[model samples]
Target: MDDKTAELRDIFLDATGGEGTVTERQAERRGSLVDVDDPETVDARLRDLVATMRERYDFATDLETDAYLRLIRGFYGDETDAALADAVGVDAETVAWARLDCHLVRDRDRDDDAPDAIRERAVAADREATRANDRFRDAFVDLLTDADLSGRLTSDSREDGLREATEDIETNVSL
Candidate 1:
């Protein structure tokens, strides 16, 4: 194979968690009906292997696996769920639906959608719910920002001798 073909094969293999070898085994076991040279055939076989992995090992669905792979490859950004879904050959709706169906996503009750009698009670409940959501959001944002800042600060400190400044602060705080 050429360099590009070899690289693509490596990527495909990695995405399937090294299951390309398993695909070869399955093809051998099935007496060579599969044509690995054909792109369509290869995709169909890989899809089947993905399904078998899900059925046998309780692995994530193909869409979820694709999302994870994209994230790991830095192809998906913080707010690019739609792009990730598109790259994975699935829709954003399907990603959400699968997450909800698998209980990986939670459903929140909204007061605006409640009936009149329930609306009043729900409004009160929503106050607490909204507060909780705000707290969670704040915490999540803090974590992401802290992680990003830490990475940048580490790099900058190493480059500009700022680590000594941080050490000085640490020493003063400890006194």
Candidate 2:
């Protein structure tokens, strides 16, 4: 990989709190791998991470949400276009545009309507969340395509499983 690619890979790994190393024997014992090499792999392993972050970390404003996205994206690549798009299902072009919109929206900085700002921020969060979810879906699909898993896991199934996993984590954390 080139320097940029390597950097992006590292960012993604760090964002997901991954150590970026997995042994086959260990995977066999644990039934999972860690520090995935590609977008698909990262998505599969960290499907619940985004939701966990959203639910557990309190964000007071849109700025916080923006910061969260930046942090998550940083874990992938600084470019945003290539790294985020690959991580998510969207094409790099689409991500570029969404990011542009995000920037424009931020630049507008119109908070006169607190209700509107809240609503817009909520929408933005949902958009980012959806993108992250798509990355998980794409990763699962890639796994199925590679015959890494028994059968293709439906998006709904993957989502439900993630939700359950997040709930379990929350329960455990609260204990």
Candidate 3:
């Protein structure tokens, strides 16, 4: 890929926190990819469009949101655009725009032929992160519950306890 393509891909990946692919149906909905001789123009147009879409959809670049998107795509499996949108809590047009973003990222040759394997890896990684977060949250909550700070304690002592508790929990989590 060219420098412009690489940079655009990085931007999309950073914004979405996932390197998803555009399916054939999504490509159809997206109409056509940008066609320009100058990579700079293509990059600028794509960046602006993605920015608008991201803002309009209010897509957060966080693990929880990434997990929800992944789950929606994984479970929907060949479902219609509207169905997927409903499941993911986004409008159908936003769904199309998201696919457009993915298309721009993977359209190195301006063709919608990005491999599904990349998207699969991205989804799996997101799911793994989600699970790890859940485990850490549960462990921390458990520690807080078991501690039961009865009386006022000195700052140093509280800090020490917190450090020790975190170390102990981290040892058990295995993540």
Candidate 4:
């Protein structure tokens, strides 16, 4: 072995008390920081996250914090906005607004009737937010200001424009 290699081996042996054979260390699996599989734990964790989000932002949903979390769970769990509306006895438009407030946007959130400026900006901002793992609501606010439009994201009489495949995904148990 070269002088430098022999020196490193000696240092390694000294540091490891002469057991100098190196074993490959297994890589740790990376994932969510919190355990999310337990329903009760997930429920509590989501509530806390939502509560913190509410304190930081102005939410369009008037639902209580816990109710809002359940609404989000149902949405990510594949329940349509209409079905969630029925469960809450509100219009789907309301549910859509709530969904946007929570940053749970899908491509179908683009509205044909809305002014193209608002529609385009909302879609772009939502997409960028998803890609960056950031808040769509905050980005939408900036985009709306930049476009100089009062963003009426959607109106009454519109339907869910997303395909069924797009509507269903793994339940997002986080805010």
Top of the candidates by lDDT: 4
Q: List ranges where model 3 is wrong by over 4 Å.
A: 1-64, 71-76, 104-175
lDDT of 3: 0.44
Measured by TM-score, how close is model 2 to the native structure? 0.22
What TM-score would each prediction reach against the true structure? 0.26, 0.22, 0.21, 0.49
Give the candidate order by descending TM-score.
Answer: 4, 1, 2, 3
Tens digit per residue, CA lDDT, model 4, 10-90: 999998888857685779866432333456766675666667667755666688766676667776567898888888778
State residue 112's C-alpha deviation in candidate 4, in Å: 1.2
Off by over 4 Å in 1: 1-64, 71-76, 98-150, 155-175
Sorted on lDDT, highest at the top, how do the candidates line up? 4, 2, 1, 3
Backbone clash total for model 4 is: 0
Index of the highest-TM-score prediction: 4
lDDT of each: 0.45, 0.47, 0.44, 0.63
Cα-based RMSD of the predictions, in order?
19.8, 22.9, 25.8, 16.8
lDDT of 2 by residue, 22-135 (tens): 433544444333324465655534435434544643444223333335434443333544665665555644453344333212223235643464447645655664765644
Encode model 1's per-residue lDDT on 91-125: one tens digit a residue.
76554433322222222223355345334433443
Task: Write one digit per residue (lDDT tens) for candidate 3, span 20-88.
Answer: 754335444442222232446534544444354455433433223343333333332445546757766
